[model samples]
Target: MATLTATILAGGEFSSPTDTPSGRLDTTGAFPFVGALEVSNSVSTYKGSAVAISSNWILTAGHNADLNDDGLPDTVWSGDFHLPGYGVFGIAETITHPDFSGFANPFINDDIALMRLASPLPTWSIFPSLGSAMTGDNITLVGFGRSGYGSYGYTSNATLTDRRFGQNVIDTLDLDDEGSGLAEVFRYDFDDPSTTGLPGGSLGNGTETIIAPGDSGGAALIQTVGGWKLVGINTFTEGYGGRFGDTGGGVLIAPYEDWIFTETGIPEPGVGCLLSVAFVLALWQRRRHCE
Candidate 1:
């Protein structure tokens, strides 16, 4: 499991995770992977995070799922996820990587987690539409995070913000020029600080947006192809704002298309085996001719 630590900004000071209330929305909008997360611990009490990925598999941060008292990953559990109209669903299985280290300082490694479901949920499986790749790329950040505006509720809107490379790192998008298609992977660090509009960003005291306790594992989707495609999972945050009052924060989303293929293995094992056998036979004949 990778040691998962919260990153506020690249060089900016760190801020603790806060459970602020995000304003309420219609709650009728599509929430992908809404009810897909559950925490595991016999004694220690922990709240369930979000699971914003696929139907069979759920994606989260390594810190939220690492509950084995030994800093090692054991198993994650989910009774149900708190969806909008629907209630929670019974979680079947949880798979946490043994290499996670939770959010720590010096932000060197990655902090990611995974969970599996016994039964699939078709309605919740549809991923959000993704948008173009560019720095300052306008995107929406929806979740049950702290509003930082005095109220505690879930937020749902297609707000715009700069889509940086990573949340905290120096690398951001080069939106000045763009290529065609959406095949490029635009990564954004959670801890990267904003330069201009933050409360303290310009003064060297700015923070980044953070996903509080309830917002863990939620989805950050972008508009693309008349639909929403997931970009990252709600991870943590610092204290800064993007276009709106909400500053960008750290997130841990599963790699969109690539992860899907890996989790749902294409070509099937049987088909792969058949292809391998045919290649071997052909090689054997070629060797015989040489002999």
Candidate 2:
């Protein structure tokens, strides 16, 4: 019941890719906390975006976590899937929210997921603060998704290897209240700049950075009083290609911060780098596997 633009692989689809339109590669100087998520079926490889919420934990989409829908993964890894800014890291498992009932629940929501890394990240890695997204906040969407726009965009099976970032303002929020297909997520527009007053406004002046197939589980960041906030995770889009009026959606992250902390004992410090390796060593030795 949900229509999306994520590149399809094997039998699953990825919401957006690593390469965004007119964006640049994110290095430790730019986007060190973000990384590329890679999935494989032995012979083939696919990509998605992964947000490192903690030193040893990654936040991504539920679908990206387990692409096969069988609750078992053939292989999962992050970081070195693409580009040079990131280093390769292996994912131990995909942990979906207990309340997430796939993408077709009556609420039409809850696609959030997290992954555990084999080791803890260095202290230099940043953890974005948590903030509530309102209707008018400006958002920066980044990914290594497909390159090009519309028909020129890469195919669902395409494997892009670059990182890019785009900008758009929040079109709407609390979508479930609208009872529309966009329920449970926030939306930004890829409208024509000529089309003023369009919902969420067009991409506006300068380079229009819209999410394309391959960016699934990437970061939808919003700046707050504290600093840049990790507001959402790339979920889906209305159109497959880079057509105009295409809307990108990501699950809200602030709502689930508590669950993430309780499960992994990872501290929640959005702004600045305060991740203490000493605090999480015990959990590291006694990692609890999720169902």
Candidate 3:
């Protein structure tokens, strides 16, 4: 594995190593909706990440759905999704966005897809609400990707079964990333706290990190007053692999919200207005009692 010198963020001085290859593990079972995707055909098997958006619908990167690279989705592909604690479920169907360029194109856009599970997951399964990402927003990323420290980047020794959590802030919104002529994406750099004057200003939240192979289709979420919202779907990265200073981002969910809802028939959560009504009713009852 390769390694880089550790620099302190404050004074630009050398410092002892404080980062590790393994991102913070999700041992507490906080992310039940996030899961691993294993799709296979007669020739090969592909590993990626996905998140449950509804009881029977899953959201993932478009590339994962088109494993054969036929310009059309491999709807007939055999696959199973493994959600921690919930057991594995077979995939019934897949739908990739209409505008997604095939894998042959280096500058692919509209890299989003949805899968229907053979059976509905448990009602208690926590599906993240849909929302948009903005620059400087602290986002939570969860996936079963290769693991390694920023100093050395991702290592091939890691397996896709290793579920990990990390954090980073959105630094830029690229409207024409890869010149795909698509909508904007939420992009961020893997900042090393020890390094200063890096692009995006070394905004490491201690857990600063980036996505690796097998992390495609992972969840990029943001916490809102209502709850956690699914904001981006992990797609691609640029730089010397997943090393520090590399830029990685995913398809923003906002631009594709209508398409997702139309395909899945799942409505966005109405918690915001519903909660307000409930609170107002409770206050009225309390005043009536006081009178």
Instruction: Quickly count the clashes in candidate 3.
Output: 2
- Residue 271's lDDT within candidate 1 is 59
Tens-place lDDT per residue, model 3, 150-251, is 665555432445577777889888674445454557788777676544656554534677787777788999988878899998877777767677777888
Candidate 1 lDDT, 197-257, residue by residue in tens: 4533322222233333444455555657657665655554433332223333333233233
At residue 145, give the lDDT of candidate 3: 71
- Best candidate (score: lDDT): 3
lDDT of each: 0.41, 0.61, 0.73
Global local distance difference test of model 2:
0.61
What stretches of model 3 exceed 4 Å from their correct place?
A: 1-17, 104-106, 156-160, 176-182, 196-199, 268-291
On TM-score, who's better, 1 or 2? 2
Candidate 1 Cα misplacement greater than 4 A, ranges: 1-22, 68-71, 75-79, 97-99, 105-109, 122-125, 129-134, 150-210, 239-248, 251-260, 266-291
The TM-score, computed over Cα atoms with residue i paired to residue i, of candidate 2 is: 0.73
lDDT of 2 by residue, 16-108 (tens): 232333334443346666667777654456678777877788887776655554333325433333324446776676678776655544443
